[model samples]
Target: MESLQALQDFIKTKDNFRNFVNSSEVPSVCKTEPCMLGVDEAGRGPVLGPMVYGVAYCPLSQTSVLKDLGCADSKALTEEKRDDIFRKMLTEEASLNNVGWAAEIISPNYISNSMYRRAKHSLNEVSMNSAIDLIKKVAESGANITEVYVDTVGPPEKYQAKLSEIYPNYKITVAKKADSIYPIVSAASIVAKVTRDHALKVWQFKEGLEMTHAEFGSGYPGDPLTKKFIREQVDYVFGYPMLVRFSWSTAELMLQDKAATCTFEEIDDELPKKKVKSISSFFSVKSEDGAMKRKRHKFFEERYLSMDNAFE
Candidate 1:
């Protein structure tokens, strides 16, 4: 395990647009006793900084150790309280014996790239995959994981089903407020929230913004400082720095209204037809009113499919 300062320094060294993981050595007790793992995330709503998915595992019988460390509902805890709990998790002998944790930091640029790709990937998919990967990493690190708990915002049944399918041997529970209901999940939430807070604090803008995190305040769209940054700190050609998620509506709409307009060529999803067909089609499909109607492929016609003017 790294000291808090070491973790922050490590995060600062990485490229702002890439994803990375930080993990502790698996506890000796975890390999011998049946363990429960909890997963949760933070910063999903923030337009600034990285979203963090965190997983924490401990022996099923030693959950009381977490309580002693002050692990509870992370959202209910103050920043100082959360930091104290995390500090104990790093330094306390009892916690070191029973608990192990890992966090994946999903960068804002990565989120934007995934959503803006030719075949768009939704934020839900990104969040799910990050959680799954953390679980896999913990299992591979020699934890005898038998139960898994996840806190999620969307419908739990589908998420639970997906996790159950992936790890049939383990008992899986995906709930709306698992962080508050489960101690292990609360621990995971603390890990995620603390990591996200530090990530923003240590953020070094490659685009050379002179202001610090305090100037930008929280990354929520409603924050006055964040709104000011988005409104005033746009580049005419490249838009905001990597810290801002371009795919987010808050950033996209601001860029559209404030920056120079850029129109990209439309994506072509079909193969080009031969020139020979073009000459025949020009003369063959004229209506009685002298409007040209392009002939459709037999396969499309049979299915009653018509071309759509995407631009219109």
Candidate 2:
């Protein structure tokens, strides 16, 4: 998006539960010169809002432009600084000529569904797939990408090997804190972090909560506003709105305490089905023994009342 308002407008129109992408046009110089792309994510730990994966690419010769734009460890930068850098990416002549970026917003509902399915898909898989998709999309748009740097989602060596296997020609480096070490990855982090911040800022609750993101805070369990939202906003049958990630333990535990308990019939195809007695067995009368029956209540006993077979 060219501006924060434009990003908010775009997010408002989409189905909140579905994943979507937004990207800038690949600069002509990027297509002609060998380029490097970096990948990073935001909102991975939050119980609310979408997780965003962003990729930033530029010609290898123009890496200096990233430094000029003040790209650094995104986590260390204030929210205002990230927003300013992103705005510069939109307006600055040097940045526009050299840098291209893309982001995929992975919705909380999509994440919950992935993790809750019978054959569960972990969050790491969802994250890696999003990163791969963004990189491929950049390449398909004719960026001459020769190297990829990634902030690790899980184990660095394993993730690096996986990306290398998929893009044999491209050099891939996946490591912890790559956002701090690589300027391109830092730019990607800014893109992802800014997108996620705006996503929550403009969140429209399809469940009709009549509330704003401010009311829910940052979606971290430690945030008092978020904790209050989780404690108070609950549906007995369906649980919380799509804004909350149902698969997160924070959401799951809160829902368990506040919502109605629901059970489903579980079928196992591998186990042999046992033939059981009919439903009538539950009501069948057994032969009475000489043993004493249950005592009558005091009220009945005081009246010398007795229970007998009405039909007899």
Candidate 3:
């Protein structure tokens, strides 16, 4: 009885402990240099829906506004909280630009490769273009842009290379976790996530697919609901919908498993013959000096099929 009473007393002191922790004094906003644009992206790992990327420009004058808004990583917030923040950002802030890359449905065999290559390419292209556009607009309005910071997707150097390829005139810095360090990047994260969620909702409505409250998460592989959605769609007899990235390895594996379960002799016969490809003959490779070399490497490279080409 004494131990139970002590536990109750400890529980009663929780609010006081919280108040003590919260009372620690700290500066509201960290000082940062002016005129740097922060860029970040969202929706890269989702098995379904389009990848959304965003860029936000903070001109250093509004640092306190960001701090007051509680600008931090979007992943750290609940969906409702993110939506609230997103709304506040759009209404109150005028220096933000959000862009998205929508990958339409292709056949399942190509989803993983297509997403990794083409989807990423598309997202990067869009992000760069949007950043350039926003910077140009800001400059025309008499705002100076000294540097641009981006949350690195692949590598820091690669971003510089790609940005140079896209926009040779501007200077850019690409670093991993820029979103966590920079308020502008955090704002971009919010825009990208909110935009993606809206797009997903629209897609779900258009496809006539019904989902429970927990069905759509951040679309990461870690989400059980996402995995379940993928499994259900893969096993569906009518074929996958137009929203699915069919090139994913998971989709291909599911399709191969389904094909294996079939009892059709015609399919079985076609399978083995199809598997045996005379690679040298197909590529017209010359077997010289005990080495096979193709005249054109492009012929052996995987072709990226678009959504329209996938069905055909």
lDDT of 3 by residue, 73-124 (tens): 8888887877766655443232232211111112122333444774364444
Worst 10 residues of 1 by lDDT: 303-312
Best by lDDT: 2
Taking all chains together, the TM-score of candidate 3 against the true structure is 0.57
- Give a tens-digit lDDT track for model 2, residues 1-312: 567788789888888889999888888899899999999999999988899999999999988889998999889999999998887776546345589999999999999999999999999999999999999999999999999999998899999999999999999999999999999999999999998999999998888788987799998888999999888888998899999999999989988888999877666755798888799765555557764454557997777666663335
lDDT for each residue of candidate 1 in 191-251, tens digit (9 for 90 to 100): 9998888889999988888788899978999999999989888999888988898888999
Which stretches in model 2 have alpha-carbon errors above 4 Å? 92-97, 266-312
In candidate 1, stretches whose alpha carbon ends up further than 4 angstroms from where it belongs are: 92-97, 266-312
Please list the residue runs of candidate 3 whose C-alpha ends up more than 4 Å from where it truly belongs after superposition.
1-34, 92-144, 164-169, 205-207, 235-238, 259-312
What is the number of backbone collisions in each predicted candidate, taken in the order shown?
0, 0, 7
**lDDT: worst 10-residue window of model 2:** 303-312
Candidate order (lDDT) = 2, 1, 3
What does the lDDT come to for candidate 3?
0.53
